[model samples]
Target: MNGCCYGRPTRLPWGVSFPPSSFAGLEFGNAKIHPSQLYFSLAGLVVFAFVWAVRKRTGPAGTLFWISTMLYALVRIPLDFTRAYEPETAFLSAFGIEIVESQLSSLAIALFSLLMIMRLRRESLAPSAA
Candidate 1:
């Protein structure tokens, strides 16, 4: 998680080109971009800190995980727009989709957040005597 949140964004500029060669036709320039990985890493750290603060205040089981996941999803969804992506890549074209790594990560985080939320709700509703 930290690698994805910190490394990808920073390392990409050294060699990785956006809109990759697969989409050579697309207009792409070698512009020094922001270090998004660092941003994501900081975001993760903030979420971690928030979760740590709320761990005792929140309920049991997956509460922290769910909340963190939701926060990550929310942040990633918008970050996707800022990151470069190749719309013509096999991964994107496979399902007639146009999504980048950030978008995919956001989707996964959202799904996990939903699942955790449901689990937390279920646990809360269960009989205490059981």
Candidate 2:
């Protein structure tokens, strides 16, 4: 979320002040954008561990995939919250309320996965006694 995707162009305090090609065309001098670098790389490892733990609990095979996706999104919400906002597309204004699109999307993804997991777990636990 902090690359060319949507993060705002920022001026870094620790850098040489020069008009590089990437920043030359930009409006502000020395305002650097993320250089296609990694954001929270450790998050992937954490998600892997979470999925592994859940799988070891006898979770359904696909539950591992679902939990992985859900946990990643859950982490994204906070990451985006602290991230630099995109100058143009950071927030949506509607009904007199301003909301961050990234946060909303992350939240939606997390909720969807949680509901799916719960439904699958409930079904799996149901008895055939009738």
Candidate 3:
């Protein structure tokens, strides 16, 4: 079910394309993906390496997955600001502060991953069963 989850359509001089029927959802009638997706993809790889290195220093533990997620959110939210967005994109709000849905979702993911990492660190530091 890979619907149009890229969040926004791209308007670059050289953008991407999808078969009209291939995409089940397209409010903008554009065939290309957001140009920022390129940035996100490349940054994602860098973040993966960074998270891997950090996890190695931290411990060969279960928190790498959580760490990766947090790092990805850190990478995405900022880039999203520069991405071209259509009018129909869903948004999330807090106390009259309105933010794009994906950005807010990224924040939530980062927070949760941070919590998981902290909890896991605490557990790892605790004394093992005798």
Candidate 4:
């Protein structure tokens, strides 16, 4: 059987409510946060497009994968900046770290890019002297 029968209903809870609000007048405290999940999903699709475009380019087997992942991370980081985050409290910690979303994303991209470059280099060198 499909999983839907076993799952709960998908509608929002009946008691929850929201006042009519516009994007411009909404403050961080009063406004609903931007949907970061949907943003990331769109970013993923963009990355897929990029990978598909680059797949046939002459370079390495895994280059497109790495590039796509890096770009996705880069996009997500900046997008996260526009989102609302909960206030830090004694019970809640953002891992005790204070990194801008873009910075973190860039770092991840850099590391993955480096790994891809190294892997490509090794692959290219493998059959050269044989």
List TM-scores for all candidates, in order.
Answer: 0.59, 0.65, 0.65, 0.55
Off by over 4 Å in 3: 1-34, 90-98
Task: Report the C-alpha lDDT of model 1 over 1-130, residue by residue, as the tens digit.
Answer: 3222211223344534344332321333433444556566777888889888888877777787788889878777766544545445324544544566667777887988888888888879889984
Off by over 4 Å in 2: 1-19, 23-37, 92-99
Q: Residue 63: error of model 1 in Å?
A: 1.7
Best by lDDT: 3
**Candidate 4 local lDDT, 32-125, one digit each (tens):** 4444445567788988887788788837777766777677767765665544443341222366544554556577786878788678868877
Location of the lowest summed lDDT over 10 successive residues in candidate 2: 1-10
Candidate 2 colliding pairs, count: 0
lDDT of 4 at 44: 84
Candidate 3 weakest lDDT stretch, 10 residues: 22-31
lDDT of 3 by residue, 1-130 (tens): 3544443555666666545565523454545665455677789989978976776676537788888888899788887774545546648555744467788889999999899999999998899998
Tell me the alpha-carbon RMSD of every candidate: 7.1, 4.8, 4.6, 10.1
